[model samples]
Target: MHIVYPAVVSALLFSIGVYGVLARRNTILVLMSVELMLNAVNLNLVAFDVWLRDRLHAGQVLTLFVIVIAAAEVGLGLAIILALYRNRRTVDLDRLRLLAETPAPTGSTSVPGAVSPPSSGPGEGP
Candidate 1:
């Protein structure tokens, strides 16, 4: 019944979630990690709410809000990941460079999906 028990478990869950997010190369795994972290937070909130015996149950209410947000995040995140997989055919975070933060090399020619200049037609004069 001690708050310490739930708190310790929450800490452990959060730690694992952080590790997964940092170490996993797959975007889906990272999303799952984020859900795990959010769940840890939810566990803490409910535990504290029960411990404090709040009349309004604010902690539980906030936990519900967090759950709603997490659901939306999962939906949108999966949608984006699926779209990327369809377009580029890979889910490895390191390999997926369409959204790379670094600028493209100046000398690089023909960026992905870039349309080349149209050739002069026979009718058009040089």
Candidate 2:
């Protein structure tokens, strides 16, 4: 088979991934879309590696490294998503934006104002 076949397929997969990333509001779905894009690139790399006459297998080696890095990315992404969901109780990006704009609760020591030091220099105090 010609190398163009795999290349075309990879391009389609990458397009789908781009659409998903843009259309999806859920963080997990976005991450999944990114993974799909990586898979497409990997497929193209492997296909080219097989078709090439070189003995070094550069494309295949690069695909292996890509797979390894993708795994690490997924692991880290999941951990971050889990932490965000636990803290906010929702994974929707819209809701997250609302949370960001809201002011901190009264008497909450975690707020920035609670941690700031009192002014010590002249003309610094209200």
TM-score of model number 2: 0.76
The residue-by-residue lDDT of candidate 1 on 1-126, one tens digit each, is 999999999999999999999999999999999999999999999999999999999999999999999999999999888766654556788775554334547754332422222343221135
Best candidate, lDDT-wise? Answer: 1
What is the per-residue lDDT of model 2 for residues 35-123, given as tens digits with 9 covering 90 to 100?
99999999999999889855999999999999999999999999888866545556766555542324656854331321232334221
Cα error of candidate 1 at position 47, Å: 0.6
Off by over 4 Å in 2: 98-126
RMSD in Å for candidate 2, one decimal?
8.6
Candidate 2, run of 10 with poorest lDDT: 109-118
> How far is 17's C-alpha from truth in model 1 (Å)?
0.1
